[model samples]
Target chain A: MYDFSADIADCAQAVEAALDAYLVPDRLSGPGPAAIRIIDAMRHGSLKGGKRLRPLLVRQAAAVFGVAPGQALTAGLAVEAIHCYSLIHDDLPAMDDDDLRRGRPTVHKAFDEATAILAGDALLTHAFALLADPACHPDPSVRIGLVTELALGSGVGGMVGGQMRDIEGEAGGFSGNDIAIMQAMKTGALIRASVRMGALLGKADPEALAALTLYAEAAGRAFQLADDILDVVATPEAMGKATGKDAAMGKQTRVSQLGLDGARAELDATIAEAIAALTPFGPPAEALRATARFFATRQS
Target chain B: MYDFSADIADCAQAVEAALDAYLVPDRLSGPGPAAIRIIDAMRHGSLKGGKRLRPLLVRQAAAVFGVAPGQALTAGLAVEAIHCYSLIHDDLPAMDDDDLRRGRPTVHKAFDEATAILAGDALLTHAFALLADPACHPDPSVRIGLVTELALGSGVGGMVGGQMRDIEGEAGGFSGNDIAIMQAMKTGALIRASVRMGALLGKADPEALAALTLYAEAAGRAFQLADDILDVVATPEAMGKATGKDAAMGKQTRVSQLGLDGARAELDATIAEAIAALTPFGPPAEALRATARFFATRQS
Candidate 1:
């Protein structure tokens, strides 16, 4: 097995630096002075933390198809922006209402609720602008394609819609299928999009893209299962977030349905499926294969 | 003076229909069963609503360069989606805390606050997806251009940034120029983008686009001034929203700084400036001229 830990750390560092450059308050010195406050809030929410797992997937998947690193990094940043914005909103008082994210005060806790909301909104808006900019891709077609993919992954039928379902499920009555669908939309959609977008950047042929799609779907499921497992077994100190939250909130999850041993078995199988789907690209997919294994076994 | 009232109503109807078609819960029948709740919330917040002013501007502006009505309407609805999402988020308890909008319960009031937030997020995402879609235009460049324009107008330097300023102003230290810049961002950015999107659809040249920019800025100022004046004078019934909010919140506005008489005078001058900027395109700009006049004198 290839070691991908160093590769993950390097990608995370690159994403952090790029996010820093993008979230600066330079706009405050211009006509939009109010922008500095939200920019500050955005930086607080996005900078210096997180696994950058989605961006690393983008870089690794694009590498398999031989896409330029710069182009993949730009698209990855856009995906990260969406991911960061979703976390900010999810942690708001009206949503998950968590006080800590990445082991620090959440955006609303650090600033104010109003600033947090605006910061999330700004980051979401910024993602589209970043994708639409010529710097994202020299060809307008690619830029528009990226925008479409992102919006589909994040919009009504995807992440936000899944969030609505999750909130509704708090009152109980969610089945195993409901849990799967909700998890897919809430977390899996963006993860799938991260890989698909990388393949897009590479302009992979239809069969190659289809194989990547299969790989991403399995990866997305395995990632969510890991999160569910972490929610049950990890300590708050290790997770940087409260653990046992699913039980505390009485939220329905795969672990709740399948039992601990069964869920672990499923996760191992999911990881194998993810790695198997990447077999088409052989050595080019070695990093993707390592990343899939990493998803199921990582503590946080 | 040319009468655009009938044209305005007709365009508004077209936009309403388009919004209805786009926001249906058909996705509920497919893989995303959770999508219906947000879709319903989106419909509740958007359908049979306000004057559809932004979409109206897009249609009229696109009409100036002989663009197809269908293309212009598509672009206009994208702008309106941004407008709708901004309103939904702005009415959150953490923000303006408005319980009523357009004389009905706000999304947060009608649905839960969580649903309202997701609905707003969904709407914002939907707008970009609509623009990036192939149905938006035959030319990918045109679609990408609309995305760039909409993002710039709605992102941090524009509408959402202005919202932060307005929230900060509730503590009351805004100078007159501060009010102008903030209003330009909060309300004017989307307005400017509305017309510019229309021009983009028509492939307007640099000089003509410049003229439209001038017209839009003046029109934007005039529209906000009229709104400020209306807040002072209109009844709750007439406005379909609570009147006297600016004063009650102690928020600064043009009317707060300049006496009502002064604000009205400025509005008249702004309207005139907007009309004068249209001199470059004689009869082609008659509807835009009427829209400027309508913005200053509208009761609601």
Candidate 2:
């Protein structure tokens, strides 16, 4: 079994450092006060603590392709910024209507709703700006690839699309297949982009991209299953956010569809599939496989 | 002196043709139903009839720089998409809460609030995708420049930022300087970008770019002042949308600050300044100058 306690901790620390440096106050200079506030709000959402799972996936995939860990920091930062923006918007009054996020007041709850909306908009727009910065990457092709990956992943066909389905699926019962589709998009898309971007940054070959994608998909599913189980079984204090809200809202979840035991079984199978997909990637993939196991079984 | 009816008719036709091509059954092929609905809603908002002023500015600026008109269409489409997205979001219940737009129900009123929000998100994301397409411009540098222009013009530093300030200024009194800053971003930024992108597409010199920026700034201010004048003088039927809503909402306006006659004088001076700025670009800039004149005095 992979030991995530140490490795994932290191990855999380690296992500935090990179994000702080990336979103430094100097980077947002020259814009007017309105623009500055938007940037500040984006930083507020992005710099807040999370597990940094997406950025970690990016770093590990880059490692598998022989990229130095430090060199992957910029790509990892860009992906995290996009993820952060999505979360800010998803928690808005018109969307998910959540007041707390990651154990603290959400951006909208901290700022006004309009400011939060604009902050999310600015963050999404700025993610592309960062990726397109030629100074950030030596290869133009890589920058283009990164932009395309991010656009497709967070755009209508990816995360946002998945979110729309999740909202739509709330009113009606969704099939297991439908639930899978939503999970793949609402959560899986960004996770998948993390690995794909890491491979592209490291100049990985076709085989490596395919393998990493499979690994990310399995890991993503396991993570969602774990979230579903936690939503039902964990307390708000333990989970750091509201629990059982999804079920109360009549949203379809693994626990609702598969029951607690079946959901736990599915999580185990997904963790195994994730690990199996990483077999061809060898030792560099060890950390990622361990991360998946940790995601599947974590209490919070 | 300028006849805008003919130009508006032609631009509307162009927009419709392009949108019809975009919305054909084939373009709707996607994984999820929610994605399809969001895209449909986006197309519905974006393709609807309007003056197409931004695209025309792009085309006219390109002509001034001697580039083929065809080169302006895609950029024109991209700008319109951004503009429409902004309008949709601005008209949301949390924002402007308008029921009618351009003689039709607003996107949020036509669809549900959630779909309207998602549609705006989809259009904004897709605008970059359209600009970045290889087919849109073979030169990577050109594509990058367009992306930068569009992103900056739409972000907090540009239109969205301006909208935020507009809201704030209305709720809380602003100084003249604050009003100018908001106008520069809210209206002037995209107008400046429309001309700048046109010049870039035409590969115009730095001198020409500078001239176009000046012209666009003056014209954009003139346009907004004319809008202020119209809101007081024109009826709802004549305006094709709700008028006088600004005053009702206690929003700041040129007329409010400078009086009606003073605002009219400012509009005239702004139009003259726009015309004078174009003198450096010679006769080819006449159409652009004429467009500005039309904006100042047009009934709609």
Candidate 3:
């Protein structure tokens, strides 16, 4: 069986390395002082530490399909960039209103709210730029597919839709099923895209694509369920950002709907289902299967 | 001479028709009431009344390059979507804080701030989705090129960069050159992209592309100068939205830097240069040339 924990760690490192190279001072050349500040703000938000799990999925799926990891780097970077932009915007004064992110001051707190907003906007647009860069991938079909995947995952039909439901649910009321739908769109879309994109780049067979989709969906749910449990159990320092904010906002969550223990049970079921879905791929998907387990049980 | 005024008007109408079709209520189908609300909010913000000038350029440029006008429709719609997204975000409380746009309530005023933000985010992402859709264009290279153009025009190196400069300039202290740079990025990038994207779609020769770029740059400057003039000379009713917001905010507009008459003279010169840049393209570019004149003189 492939060591999924080690594979994910390697994938994360690869994503971080590419991001570091892309956001290096030299890459932002030819702009005035204000532009430079905006670029700096973008780098500050994007380059800071994160798990890089989404990009890792992209890379790993590529590996399973026998494509070079480098082949998926640009798409991986683009996905992470979108993820970073979402985090920045979500932490804005009018959104989640968080002061911290990944153990550092959130973009709005580090810079001003206007700068943070602009920075987020810049990063979001830049993700497409990276994907479209001729130097990254010569095949236009691949580029187009990657772009569509990322956009749909991040847009109203996906993450934004999920966030809208989240906030609206807070204002109204929601059942467990409603919470699941919200989580699926908000977090599951990107997770599914990560695997799908990686498979696309590797040109994985139809069977593998279907299995990966199922794996990602279940893993995504497990990740969110774990998050709900963490919010209740993890301390501020341990969590690296504000915890328990979901409950404070009177928002619906797996924990809120199912209770902490119930949420944990759900997480276990999700992880098992995620792994089971990958059984069609046999030992080659062991890494993915392990990653699902890890997601369900991560301390942070 | 090609009658650019009539041609551009037709192109604009064609693009609007396609956009209207694409945004029909059926396209937003999915689970969750909140998701539907978000989708509706995005469609409302993006599909509301506007001149459709940016999308028209994409169509016109495509025509200039000899591509079928039908081939440019999706690309045109994509650009307009991006334009609408920017407007929605720019009107948010933390940004321009405007209550009105195009004589109607701004997205935030019509919806909540959070919903408006998500709508903008969704539209921006959806623009790319449209560009990348295989059904829209069979050529992946064309899609990739379009994505690149749109991204650069909208991101830090273009519109977002200009916005940052505008915000920073308002905090006080900037030279005339700084103001020019800001305007070029904020308004000029997308305008230039409109022309360039059209040329790209038409498969214009490199020389034609260069000429179109120059034309777009000049026209963009003239367009901004005209806006400055209108802000000073037009009333709220004449301008559609607030007329004097730029001056009130101490923005470094052409009218603020030069007297109103001086700004008018500059606009005239820029428009003349824009028209001159199109001379090499012969009668084929008459529509673009006329559009330049329209941009210079438009009151709103």
Candidate 4:
């Protein structure tokens, strides 16, 4: 009965606007040409449309606790900027070496490798600045907490660490458990932060925080499993990037480990668990519950 | 009549210890082996000794306001970590491509290029986290201020932007004024943050803040000029790395722009200006004045 698609669209538009406001390429402020180049790369990498799933999750979670849409939107944009940066870096020649992202030339391919690297670095740093700004939260503690959570999710202990493992796995062998932990770090950590940040901004009690965290963890796993399934089952045209790149690279994805059927089964189970975790909030959490269900079935 | 050599050494030790505490490679927390590898690279890049000039400047600035040594040291370490991260990235093949740093293999040389990149990213992220932590400052506003200052100093419009220009300048030709602006961003921004963060933690008044800002700007420019002079004159044995790199690459530096004698004159003038800026602080700023003098003349 509850649909998140419209809400997702609205949040994505707001986040895009916020990102534009945050990233005006000021030639007078520093090195003119260089600043333009990096800012262009940043905009190129970030502004192209995607699912905007993370920001939507932030909004949906916030909506559950009556947090201001504007406040939730700021946190969402910060997290999205970080996500955009990670994608840019991940597409670098030394990294995944992908030339296309979101149906266009990747940051490195569009600009240059050095610019891409610097753009990624800038975006990551700017994310913290956004969180730290007074506009993000009234209470400094909440702002500090946002910064801390984002750093933990996106830094060495989370996304970067998982990226390292993922790269290593290309050579490779990894147990399912090892892969699971890597997925948790690489994808789940940020997703968890995206969901929980809205809750934190809303000043959710400890019990609600724990429950939402569990829900986010389940939803994150489901999302990854669905991604693995799509990598094998979907066409490159449908996905907007190369499909089966994971298989080509010998990546030990869930689909490879558990097979398509098992992976789908796992995704369904996780989605069910995610929905169950929202029982405390009951009807008010319908949007979040709908988001969890959608994650396991999202086509592109 | 005050010498700050002992004070510098004491501050350096404290900063090093704090860096170690902040960068513990906890395998159980994230992607274990990959985390260890990146942490190793981070430690390798950061732990090996240098002059600790930035942290020392922070401490000296804080001392003027009687800020607690521990609080100053924490802020100092955060700035130092950013410095270390910059060095690691600058030494990458896509950037400066230096093999040795401070007489040891650069991070990319010690580890792989990917690990070096990730390590730099981790350190940069961790720096903001350090600034945002309550341990860094009891006041959340001060912590947020540190985060904002650092983000501005190190992001696209600051150090990274400056580095972009520096990299582009390799094919060669930048005006004297252009080099000055670039140098301010490339090196001076973080240095300014170092001085300002200490004073900020100490809650310096607006007038004092302005004076220290001027002093830091002059000192930073002077320090870079000294480095340029050293690059031309100091032996690799003394400098702990290859000398004449700027000349060999046809890179424009203060020395290249102004000639050796002229560069030295500028350094002297900047040092004098730095000292004059501290006239308001009087004897409380003795160590800072000594530091500015040291910047103009320190050898490898």
Candidate 5:
């Protein structure tokens, strides 16, 4: 009976507005104005369009602890910036080489490759700076904790490390378990970080934090599994980026490891597990439960 | 009486030792092991060679306020990591496109572009994580301040902005003033940040901090001017990387705006101004004064 579309849409709108403010092309970090070209590329890379799934996850996870949407948006914005920056780098010629992202030209294509690279680097730096800003958390200690979580989630043993592993896998290939590790690091880490960061922002106690962490881990797997299924079934037009490109690259994914039907079955089980992890909070976690369901059936 | 060469050597040795400890290939940020390929690439890019000039700057500047080299070393490592990561990205084929760094093949050339990109990303992220560590500063507030300084210094309006401007300069051409701004943003920002971060770690009073900022700005310009001179005059063998690269690519620098002799005179004046900024601290700031002179005269 729960409708998540409206809630997700509202969260996305708020996140995008905050991101727009953060992406000011002329904002000064020094005496001279910021490079308009790089800032534009950052805006282009981040502001255009996407599901804003990560920010929504942050909001929903925080809502479970009675945190208001306004209170969680800063952390949401920080996580979203990291996501956008990663996509920009991933689409570069040296990496995934995709020209399209969110159905528009990637940063490198919209600007120059050099601008795109600088934009990615700046956005990555900006994410940490945003976390340090008092608006993210009044307490410096809590802000530092958020910084640590986001850095590790997207950094070497997490997203970037996963990408490296997947790249290595491209050469040496991946086993079934390798696929899981790769997926966890590449995507799951950031997703998990988004949820955990939200709980941290709410000052969730250890028991609540543990419950949320478990929920996040399961939900991360569900989201990734659903993505693999979508990759196999969705079209570029529907997904807003090159679909089937991963498969075309012979990238071994969970879908490749467990056949398509098997992956879909796993996704359903994963979402159910994700929902079950929230059982301790019952109706207080309905938003997250609804989010888990939405992940499986999303068209884009 | 101030023979800086030996002091410089000792600082470099200590920094390299700490960097070696920090650059472990298997340090985990998550459940999965870090990608060995990316970690190896990080070590290759960061550990192989260089002056460790930035860290030494950090040490000397911190020492002005009686901060021990040991107290400043963690910050030294963080700033150096930023410097190294920038070098890795700057050398990418889509950017400066050099195949060499520190007398060795550049990261992209050695490992592949993908690994180089990931290594740079991870290192940049790791920098913030390092700043938040207890060893960096016992006070979370000061650590947060460090993160903000480093981020802004290397971010959109600073180093990355400068690089983007330089790239744009490639297509549009640069005026004399434009070259100065580019130099300030590209190389100047991070150098300035290194000095200020050192001062912050030492808890310099506002008046002392202002003096250090002025000194840092002058030193940054002197260092950039010297680097411009070296690019024109130094050999690839001596510099340990591609020399004459900016010129060959028609990249504009201060040396381009002011001819070689003019730039040499400016460098001397700049170093003098740097020294003048430290007059308030007198003997306490002698190390920083020595550092300013060293910047103007370094061969590589």
Candidate 6:
């Protein structure tokens, strides 16, 4: 079995370092403190401790194709930055109104709302800049591929569109399919992008890419189902945020539409499907396989 | 002697077409209506008529290097999209608190604030996607250049940073230099990016690019100065948005710092310098020179 836990820790550390390196402007003539605060808030939102699953996914996917860890780390940072920005915006009073994230105050709670908003915007913008940097990839076409994929994953057609649907679902009217689609967009798109970007960076063969895409789709749904299940079963302290928010806000989720047992069954099937998608790659995809199993069983 | 008026109208129509072509997904399987509303809000904010001056600048600058209008237009739409998204976010109640934009209800007023925010986010994301698109430029490097330039121009280090300064400036006590820096970032960066993108798209020589850079800087300053002057002298009816916001908010502006006459003199001299930067290009820059002259004299 692949030591995914160690791999995740290593990937997280590298991504954090990459984020710090790229985010803190190396130029001596930086803007004043007021401007610096925005950067601070961005750092605060993005660098806060989390599972770093997205970047881990990127690195693992890249590993399957013999890509360098350092190069994969940079692309991973781009996806994580996008993910962090989305989290920041999602925590806004105009949205989820969450006060906590990852056992700390949400960005809006830690900083003021306006600063949080600006910080989120800045982070989102910086992700593209980071991907375009030569450090991310030698070939310009590779960089463009990463960027366009990310934009589709994070923009209106993907994450943002999913977010709007999420907000609309707060009134609790979504059917099972709608919930799946919303979850895919809001959370799954970036996760899917994470895997696909890594594969792209490694210049994976088309067949491998196709298999990975399938794996990502199944894995993404399993990840969301796991999250929904955690929301129902985990404690607020354990989860590092409010528990039962899905039920409280009447937000339709897999656990809500499907009973907890039903959701668990779906998660099992999805995880199985995710692993099956990787069957063509054999032992090289052990890390990714472990990841799907981890997501399905993860409590926090 | 170029009839810039006709050129401006032509540029606007062409950009509108490009934006429509790129933005409205021709695929019949578009997102559902709720997701479509977010797209609608984005289109509402971006597509509604304006001078399209930024795109016009991109087109004119591209013309300087014999770049195709279609390619330049794509890059121009990218910049215009960024500008529109900025305006939408700026008009939010948490930000500028304006209710009118282009003489129509702001996005937040027409749609809810959450929708407005998502729309702005989507638009910003889309701008990068447009630039990364192979259709924007044949060379991947050119697309990467455009993406990176647009990111820096629109992101925290540029426009967003400038906006923070703007918000901070509202409490008053800004030096003239501070105001200049803020304006350069807030409004000037994107304008400069527009000209630079067009030139880059056309593969202008380094010398020509350097000259255009100088011209862009001078013209950018002149553009902001003209805007400050308009804020003081123009009416809301004429300006389309609320006038005198700078003065009313106690925000520092060129006109506020320099007084009307001093600001006007600065504008005239800046316009002269902007035109002079194109001296190396001779009559080929007539359109650009006319643009500077127009900014100096336009009432709105």
Evaluate model 1: give its TM-score. Answer: 0.97
Tens-place lDDT digits, model 2, residues A1-300: 646787678878888877677554455321333455666677778875788888888878888877877777777777888888888888888888999887888998887787787777776776776776775467766776777777777777778888877877875668759888888888888888888888899888888788888998898889889999999999999876899998898888888888899999999998999999999988878777778888877888
Model 3 — TM-score against the truth? Answer: 0.95
Clashing pairs in 2: none
Regions of candidate 2 where Cα sits further than 4 Å from its true position: A1-7, A10-26, A29-36, B1-8, B23-34
lDDT of 5 at B247: 79
Please, what are the lDDT tens digits per residue for candidate 3 over residues B173-249? Answer: 68758888888888888988888888877777889889899999998898888888888889999777998877787
lDDT of 1 at B16: 93
Clashes of each: 0, 0, 4, 0, 0, 0
Chain A alone, TM-score per model = 0.96, 0.94, 0.93, 0.95, 0.96, 0.95
Regions of candidate 4 where Cα sits further than 4 Å from its true position: A26-34, B27-34
Question: Ignoring the other chain, what TM-score does chain B have in each prediction?
Answer: 0.96, 0.94, 0.93, 0.95, 0.97, 0.95
CA shift of A215, model 3, Å:
0.9
Q: Candidate 6: which pairs clash?
A: none
Residue B267 Cα positional deviation in candidate 3, in Å, after optimal superposition: 1.4
| Top candidate, metric DockQ | 5
| Residue pairs clashing, model 4 | none
Q: Is candidate 1 or candidate 3 better by TM-score?
A: 1
Question: Model 6 TM-score?
Answer: 0.96
Off by over 4 Å in 3: A1-5, A24-34, B1-5, B24-34
**Which ten residues in a row are the worst by lDDT in model 3 chain B?**
B25-34
Per-residue CA lDDT of candidate 1, range B14-112, in tens? 999889888876632222444677888999989989898898898788889997667788788889999999999999999989999999999999998
List, residue by residue over A72-171, the lDDT tens digit for candidate 6.
8878888888889888888988888889998899988887877788888888888898898898899999999999889888877578888988877775
